[model samples]
Target: MPQLPCQGCRGMCCGPVPITESELKRIRKYVRGMPLPARSKLEGQLRFFGTCIFYDQDQDKCGIHPARPAVCRAFGLHRNLVCFRMPEAASGEAWAAGEPSVGVLSADFVWNDFK
Candidate 1:
């Protein structure tokens, strides 16, 4: 797979990501496992409205990358989830979720929900 041109994007495309129950559980575990300082820093960062709650704006990457939702993992690779910065990387096939979304991150879910 090609690397996304994410360095300068600051998670501009990570708004309101839909997540399943399993993904939420995984993220809860991932957050709970973080050291207080690391977790605090991540939780303290200010982001643009509508950005994913777990986006580490300071690091310019996903704070819970290892536990990111399925749609995020398939980003820029599926036709329906194309990255505007790298549209050529998207394939013709759409990405299908293995399960239904329980909530939308940064919307139905938030920093408090992960705590």
Candidate 2:
């Protein structure tokens, strides 16, 4: 499948990725012994518009792409569920029109299927 232009994406899909239990466990394991701020971000305690802690704004990519959560990997598989937040995508209007809402679609997809 053709990949979305996510490299320079404004991180429209980085917000509020509802991870599975196993994904959470993996994150916990990865964040264990890390600094408090990093841990808190991973735990969804320090989000800005629900953006993922691993999203590197400067690089416009996932900091932990190799070990990213299932939901993150499954992103863009369902076009209707994805909000292309690029300037030309007109994403704000799409969201206002109710484009499944962030995290809602991720919650619906089974983690095992993506894995």
How accurate locally, in lDDT, is each candidate? 0.90, 0.51
TM-score, every prediction = 0.96, 0.53
Q: Model 2, 1-115: lDDT tens per residue?
A: 4456776665657765665456655654555545766444534433355565566565566755666676566555544356354333332222122222223322443222222
Task: Give one clash count per candidate, in the order shown.
Answer: 0, 0
Task: Show the lowest summed lDDT stretch of 10 residues, model 2.
Answer: 91-100
Cand. 2 Cα-lDDT? 0.51
**Candidate 1 Cα outliers beyond 4 Å, as residue runs:** none
Q: Judging by TM-score against the true structure, name the best candidate.
A: 1
TM match of model 1 to true structure = 0.96
Q: Can you write out model 1's per-residue Cα lDDT over 40-72, one digit (the tens) per residue?
A: 999988888888888999889999989999899
- C-alpha lDDT of residue 75 in model 2: 55
